[model samples]
Target chain A: MDIIVPIKQVPETSNVKMDPETGTMIRDGVGTVVNPLDLYAIETALRLKEAHGGIVTALTMGPSPAVKALREAIAMGCDEAVFISDRSFGGADSWATSYTIAQAIKQAGRYDLIICGERATDGDTGQVGPGIAAWLDLPLATYVASVTTLPGADAPVGLSVERLVEEGYQILELPLPALLTVVKEIGSPRLPTLRGKKRAKVTEIPLFNAQNLELDPAFIGLKGSPTKVVKVATPKVMRSGTVVRAHDEAEIALAVDRLLAFLDERGLLPRGDRP
Target chain B: MSFVWTLAEQHGGRLKDVSFELLSRGRALADKLDTKLASVVIGDGVSPEQLEALIRRGADEVYAIMDPRLAHFVCETYSNILSHLVKTYQPTIILAAATSMGRTVMPHVAVRVHTGLTADCTELDIEPGTGNLLQTRPAIGGNIMATIKTPQHRPQMATVRPKSSRPLPEDATRVGKVIEVPLIESLIDERVRVTGYRTDTADFVNLEEADVVIAGGRGMKKAEHFGMLHDIAGVFGGVVGASRDAIDRGWLGYSHQIGLSGKTISPRLILTAGISGSIQFLAGIKTSETIVSINTDPDAGLHKVADFGIVGDLFEVLPELQRRLHEHAAAPPAATTATADDERPDERQREERV
Candidate 1:
């Protein structure tokens, strides 16, 4: 099995906050890190490779800095890394992003399985994996929690997976050359080892640009993306907070009374016997 | 007349509540555009009764595509059908509930129809001059809100967040046209088959659909601290949710996580503890009717949007809230119906136990 994991570098979200009074964004600093869930994807690929004996490749699409994320993936046990970075790839939505990545994959060669995080934190759009599968005309499963090759697999033809759904989880089987967007239930990602880190430092990641990949210029970036963000502003904060104060045990009880009154005013709690 | 189409989703022969909500919103938008509000119902064994119910719920016309092949939502099949419908009808606007099915199918249809789709929109409006659909949604992990428009594409499409709008009251006297379309078996492409479904009943928290959600963040400190949230949520007949921090810390599972990276939820009431309100996490709970925050930090950004804020330790506050809830629960049930049960009163229990 040749496993490929797609990772992304996203602006760290912890430092992003809303300035309460002004209702504006307060970005302490825009620090980038590997999209947290993609770590799980890389780990899943590494574990699959460790069990089934194959090369695990970490692939990312972004600017040059994204190579660092791929290197981090290599540090986490990926055999090789590829960066699909180009000026033409900037401002691509899920549609074009998937197309560009799928083209990059075609250039990278064959793989038995492709893994991605269920969604990217920055975009929060879980469409890229399925979009890539759609673009590639491959079987796809989203929100996969567990994956296992069919028993007695002679160069395994298919894999079974437990996929999350609205009502519950569903068991699904898809043939090889399949794509899976995984949730955290897959497993906890393993940390990088000293040897792996040393290997990562020395490895030079190959880059694939639109020109190199021979992608149609029309389908590569902002021009190719169907949807456009016309406007962006702070979301209106409509509610006003009424802070409750309590210092001691007596004050705490009074705070509870005030809370109950508030709930009653909201018709949340049943109106009990009271004056 | 041009039409505003809402995809009415059904599961196990019952229409999802969000369908009605969509129809209601679609009807309003249709009226604004001087067009008809039509609902597209695609499923196995869809009944005339269901179609009529859709009319009562605000659809002026219901297009019924009954096919066993579509019984289970195969994204390809549904998207194909929808894209074909769009091509034929050329409806100006198409809307669906931002549920699992909508999220999966809409993009495929958009790509096929060569149109644009804004996903998980919290607000939708039409531009007066251009007549383009203005889709406003939280983006960049909810740090900023973006208004998107498909000015060049016909049949402007969007998936509205479920529970963001209220469904109109049913009017039995309402009459509508029902057009039945024959299902083309050859069009369905189902590469994946659902073999079995495993419902996590014991500890499953459908955070998105929950009425009351008690969530915890890194301030809880450890996995065991979630016990307090669980106990409090249980008392309120709600579910427990977690911030991405809690899940990242391995204190909770992803299923319990509410955030940009986890799941988007719009519960009735959400009380978050120890959460400092990262924009990503706040996106998930933005639609909650009542947001109450309890954290030791007074400047915790959560207090900004929170309807009620208690600047206190979770250990101290949770116990106090729990005690008050217990006292409230001990009081007699409300005169109308059981107030202690989960919101919407589990229909199964009503049939089995009531």
Candidate 2:
């Protein structure tokens, strides 16, 4: 099996905060890391290769700094890395992003499976995976948790997978050349080894630009993106209420009384009789 | 005339609550655009009453595409059917819940029709002059809100977060049309097959549906410390939730996680212990009505957003709160003029009565 795993470099979302005075994002010290869930996708691919024997290629579409993400994937045991970056690809939405990536995949070569993280923390849309599958016209599964190969006459022809749904898990069978977006339940990611890190340090990652991939200008970036962000504003922080601090047991008792009274005033306390 | 359409999602022949919510919102958009509000239902043996219920809830028309093969939600088939509908009917706008099925199918359909789609929108409206669909959604882990537009795309598409809005009240006297479209054989793609489904037995409570939620964070320290949250949740007949830190630390299941990557919840009351609210975590619980925080640090970010803050050790405060709750529960019934439960009406029931 030849596996293709798409990954993203995202800002540490938890650290993303707003400057109350200016009402703008505080991006000065915010650092980028491989989207945490993508690590799981890379691990899943590596494990599959270890079990079934295949080459895992890490693919990404971003600015030049995204090579760091690809190298990190290499350190995590991806056999090869493909980077697609160009100024034209900037401001692409999920539709254009998936289109660019799918084109890169086509230009890269053949693959039996494509794995992606369930969703990127920054976008939090979980739309790119399905969008890529749609662009490639490949069978796709989302929120996949587990996978097992189905044996054919001579080699494996398909995969039986468990997909997470609103209710629970749905067992599905998908043929080769299918794409899957995986959730955290897939497995914990393994750390990079010394040998893998050394290989990653020297590995050559080829870049695919719009010119090489023959991407149409009408459908590559913001020009190609159908949806546009017209306006952006910092979300308002609505709470600035009373704060009570308690130290000794007496203060603790007083604090508890105040909390109970607050709840009681709002009629939020549990049903009970009061003295 | 072009309609404002909502794809009604169903499971086991019953419509999901979000489907009705979409219809209600779509009704307003339809009215603003001077168009009809139509709901598309694709499932096997979906009852006439359910189809009519869609109309009663605000759908001017319900397009029922019933077939045995359509019972289970397959992305290929559902999107194919929807793409076909969009091509034929040319709806001005299409709405769906930001659910697994909706998330899967909408993008596929949008791509097929060559249009733009905004995912997980919190607000949707028609632009004043150009009549474009204005879709507003949280971005960058919910620290910023972005208003998006698909000015050139026909059938402007967006998926809304479930529970963000309530379903419109049912009007029994209202009447509408049910148009059943035959399923075309070419639309069915059999590359993927559903074999079986297994319910998740591990989830003790539905976080999204809970009236009250008690969540913990890294300050809870250990996996065992979550017991305090569970005890407090039990007292209020609510559920336990956790921040990403707690979930990543293996102290709680993913289902209990409340954050950007987890479930977005809007419970009536939510209490967080030791949670120094991250932007991502705040995204999920910001819509909650009453937020109470307990943290040893007075300046925790969570305290900044909490309706009430207690700067104390959760270990000491939670046990005390739990004991007080127990005492409250065990108190003599005669002394109370009216119990809280008796006075507080069921929120869902109130919505229905609206």
Q: Which pairs clash inside model 1?
A: none
Model 2, B262-281: lDDT tens digits are 78777778999989988778
Model 1 spans > 4 angstroms off: A14-29, A151-153, A236-239, A270-275, B45-47, B218-236, B245-252, B274-280, B313-320, B326-354
Clashing pairs in 2: none
Give TM-score values for chain A, per-prediction. Answer: 0.89, 0.87
Query: For model 2, what is the alpha-carbon lDDT of residue B329?
Result: 76
True contacts kept of 1: 0.55
lDDT of 1 at A251: 66
Which residue runs does candidate 2 get wrong by more than 4 Å?
Answer: A13-30, A246-275, B203-206, B209-211, B222-225, B234-237, B323-354
User: How far out, in Å, is residue A10 in model 2?
Assistant: 1.6
TM-score of chain B, candidates 1 onward in order? 0.89, 0.86
Candidate 1 vs. true structure, TM-score: 0.89
Q: Write the per-residue lDDT of candidate 1 for residues B150-208, one digit (tens) a residue.
A: 88777888889877776777687888899998877777876777677778555465676
Q: Cα-based RMSD of the predictions, in order?
A: 4.1, 4.1
